[model samples]
Target: MRWFLTVLGVLFGITVFLFLDYALPSRQTVRITNTYNRLTDIGANAIFYASADAGTVQNAAGQRDVRFIDTVRPNGRPYVYRNEDTGWIWPPYFKYDSSNLHAQATDRKSTSANPEWVSVTSYGWRVSWLSIYPNAISIRSVAGPDVRPFNWPAVLILLVLGVLLFMLWRMWNQFHERSIEPAIRSADEAWDRIDAQADAARDRARGRVSRWWDWVRGR
Candidate 1:
């Protein structure tokens, strides 16, 4: 049972970590290479995108014109981001400026020769197998390609979560120490008393049997 609980706890922790990692905003410094609109089906990857009522018109076949921004890192690795309005949905970016972000990405487009670097703030993972792209929340031009902007939002969120977990841990320890431990100890003591009574009764019964047998044998 202990091993089972340990495995269950580990799985729950991993699930929460992955959910936060996906929901939290992250920054990437890359050069915008191109921007375009594509009619995407969304298909099974609809969860990765915003809701249907997020101002983007969707057809009966679940197809919509999705704006995509193509970018490349300083090391020449390519990345793609979907420009979409999150509206008042999960992740709580409340972004309703997809067109503006797309325009900004288009204006920031640069070639390798000139290389205009920009920091694109987004959330989610780009899973190629699932045809998932990170949704870009905002964009801004940066000084250079090697610029690493500090993610203050992520740090503050983590700190708050840490404090909350610490408080919960303290409460649990107190409960275990005050309530659960005492109850368990009482149960153990009750069992010990019952065992002692049973042993004494058995010894008394055996002594009576021995005395009766000796009297019947005329000793």
Candidate 2:
């Protein structure tokens, strides 16, 4: 029974550790969308500078525009960019310059227009994937599915409770085992002593009886 409790305690500890490991990584992924936005903002600023001379535009800082365009993957699933700053506000046919502005799949490939100006914005969107990762060639957007935060406080509480319970059980077991040990030893010793005394008394009685018989018989 003691061994069984010890084994159970160990299994509980292992389960807690595994849960923490799995949960922590997923929490990190939740922050990925935010991180990607920061990268996109940086990329957008860079494109703004590269697109035209800073002096050419009036109210350059205030008029700066950023939008995210919703696009479907090849699998026909909808994934809108989390950053509203980079989405497409207009249809694909709207021309940025002389060329029509079509929704291009966000990939690493360089999609440029006939005129370099049109390509400037499109290329900026395309190369924005590079900002996500320094050496990444492909822009694979994560499925913006619902994600839950790792309930760290709850986990911590559970761990603490489990540890306390395990310790209490262990201490109780030890105390009970120790409590009975001395009583068991004392009882065994007392029984042995009693048996010895009974044997001695029986032997003495038999001798006395024999002596009495001899005296009586006068043989």
Candidate 3:
């Protein structure tokens, strides 16, 4: 049981880490290679894409227009992102600036050699097997690829999340120590008292009943 519990705890921690890593917005300073509209077929891969814009219609159709930003990382690696409005869904990006972001990306486009570096803040991941790409939330021009952007947003989010988790831990500890442990202890004491009473009653009736050795042994 101890081994099983330790394994379960490790798995849960890894799962939470991966979840936050993908859901939280991260900033990357890279050079925009290009930007364009991708007529994507959204079948089972719809969850990877964002919902329709606030006023846009969300049809049951299999295809939709998704904008993509192609860029090369600071370490000279290519990165492709799908731009879409989150439409008040998971991750709570509330990003409704698809067109405006596209324009900004287009304006910031530069070559790999010259590298007009920009900081792109985005959330989500690119799973090549699932054909899903990260959604770029915002972008701004930076000095160069080597310039590291200070992630105050991520820091603030972590602080809030840490405080929430700490509060939850405290609540769980209080509930267990006050309620669960006391309940279990009371139950154990009650059972012990009942057992003692039964034993006493058996002793008191032993002489009142006429029983030979054979009867006592249940002949």
Candidate 4:
């Protein structure tokens, strides 16, 4: 039971960590290479894209026009981002300015000879297999590709989660010590008393049998 609980806790912790890592906002400093719009099929990766009901533009036949911004990191690794309004759905960005962000990205576009650094704030993961791109929340010009903005929201959320887990651990320990252990000990004592009574009754039955055998031999 202890091993089972330990495994369960580890699995739960990993799931929560993954969920937060995906949902929390993160920033990447990169050079804006180009911006364009594409007619995409959300298809199997619909969950990664915005919901039709909560998006500014509804998808027809699981297809929509998604705005994309191409970028390159300082190390020259390419990254692509999707610009869309989250509307009133999950993550609560309440972003309704996809067109503005697209315009901003287009304006910031630069070439390899002269790079314009910009910080893009967004959430979600880019899984190439699923053809999913991170949805850009906002973007702004940065001093350089090395600039990294402090993530205060993510830090505070982690701290609060830590505190809550600690409290839950304390409560579990208290309940086990005060209730479970005492009940277990009482059950053991009761079983021992019952065993003692059973042994005495067996001994009495044997003595009665011996007396009847002695009477039959004397007759």
Estimate the TM-score for candidate 3: 0.87
Model 2 lDDT per residue over 94-187, tens place? 2232111212222222212211111112211222434321111112223332323344544665688789989999998898789877788889
lDDT: worst 10-residue window of model 2: 114-123
Cα lDDT of model 3 by residue, 79-189, tens digit: 899888876878787777889999999998988657798999998898888998989999998877788898888889999999999999999999999999999999999
Clashes of each: 0, 10, 0, 0
- Per-residue lDDT, model 2, residue 12, is 95
- Candidate 1 stretches greater than 4 Å from native: 1-6, 53-57, 211-219
Off by over 4 Å in 4: 1-10, 56-60, 189-219
Could you list the CA RMSD of all candidates, in the order they appear?
A: 2.4, 21.1, 3.1, 3.1
TM-score per candidate, chains pooled: 0.87, 0.27, 0.87, 0.80
Question: lDDT of each structure?
Answer: 0.93, 0.38, 0.86, 0.88
lDDT of 4 by residue, 43-68 (tens): 77778888876654545676788899
Worst 10 residues of 4 by lDDT: 53-62
lDDT at 177 for candidate 1? Answer: 100
Model 2 clash pairs are 66-85, 67-85, 67-86, 67-87, 68-86, 68-87, 68-88, 69-87, 69-88, 92-101
> Candidate 2 overall Cα lDDT vs. reference?
0.38
Candidate with the larger lDDT of 3 and 4: 4
- Can you give the lDDT of residue 149 in candidate 2? 35
